[model samples]
Target: MEIGAYQDAQFGQERTQERSEGSAGSMADLFPKLVAMQRLCGSTAFAVLSVHAHTLLKPGKIECTTQSPGSQEFVSPFLKLNTEFLLSHLCSSPCPVIFMPENAQAMDSSPACIVRNQAVTETSLAFPVQLGTLGNGFVMFFDARAMLSNDLLIDLHRKSLTVMREKLRLAFGMTTGSENLNDREIECLQLVGNGMKSEAIGEQLNLSVHTVNAYLGSATTKLNAVNRIQAIAKAIRLGIIA
Candidate 1:
């Protein structure tokens, strides 16, 4: 069947209603719901999992996982490479959420061949969800065979973002609008992870020493670190720097 045509029939309103009823509570709750949603949308298999400290994308560790049918053969090397590439690409996005379709080109064309040459027998999609304002990591994955409608895909993406946001809020004990950090603070923290000293960073960015210090200090406070070094370390642990 034509891809577009298939998407229309399978992703009609009834499917959306089925998906809407799926409640997402814990990782365990969400995973089954994802798998069920994929099935309802005509996919053979599906999985949804998240990573904590995703350093492969930045500096520290990240929590990520993918779920598929038990019958599917496990390919460790390809999975690792794919995960690495996904995280690296996600680092460039301002919004913490990323929806990556398997056969689609990356936004940044620099590493154009990351997945082009790989042999993918089954169709699949992956989502890279950055956990919190601190850059914790993501949860994602869907079935490509499902040929989910663009509207359905979009709905899932939006819902997934909401779930991740709520999870992070609870995990970090943050309230609405209380933990938002600006881009400058994030950039400064990333530079600190690269071992750039305050004065050097100031020169690199054409900012005054006092301004650089202020950025670092603000970042440190936001990250709940007592000092710059501690801030850097926390940033790394939180997957904010790389």
Candidate 2:
């Protein structure tokens, strides 16, 4: 469902699309800035990923797969060191600017651990950027020596990300507005992400099971998600669902 001022509809669409059109070609222009941010944050490395809707809907899977990651360029030695863990962590969760094992460090938290044993850096921070209609993506920073504190990480997201958000969104080539969600759909998703089943959600929302599923399905399609679960995850990442 699209919403707009009746008179400004064309103008609004044109404006957002115009913004999207120029972003794709300028993605590479942000590399130098990212490198500078990494240095300022005292991190050893940094990287970015673009979440792709087409890749998310691959057959037989409700979630995006690492076999075909939706990440944008800005690779580094971390990819070669802890490939799958990094992708899974970055792509799956909302992970809004989290410091790895805050106030400390760890090892062997299974395959998805960022540090990945003693081989990589001691600390890592992830900033999950919300690009409005551009879909979701993240910027990660890793530290080799000192523990990257939470304050620093939050500063990066609050101050640094603000400057970088529009630039990164353009890089993703998001010209048009992203999928829209009515109050009903977003309400259903918030409950779903809270571990509610369809029946429970229906009762809570005072609607029939069929109606609840309809809203959910509509949201799923709009988000280009493979299923309700995927929809919920993406919704959380996009700040659509808390």
lDDT of 2 by residue, 19-135 (tens): 443332364555665666677667666666544333555421112211112232224444555455544654554333333434354432211223334543245555555443444
What digit string (tens of lDDT, one per residue) describes model 1 on residues 33-104? 566555645555544445444446765434335465552343343355466665565565422222333565
All predictions: root-mean-square deviation over Cα? 10.7, 12.3
> Pairing residues by index, what is the TM-score of model 1?
0.45
Worst 10 residues of 1 by lDDT: 108-117
Report lDDT (Cα) of residue 30, candidate 2: 58
Give the winner by lDDT. 2
The per-residue C-alpha lDDT of model 1 at residue 239 equals 36
TM for every model, in the order presented, reads 0.45, 0.40
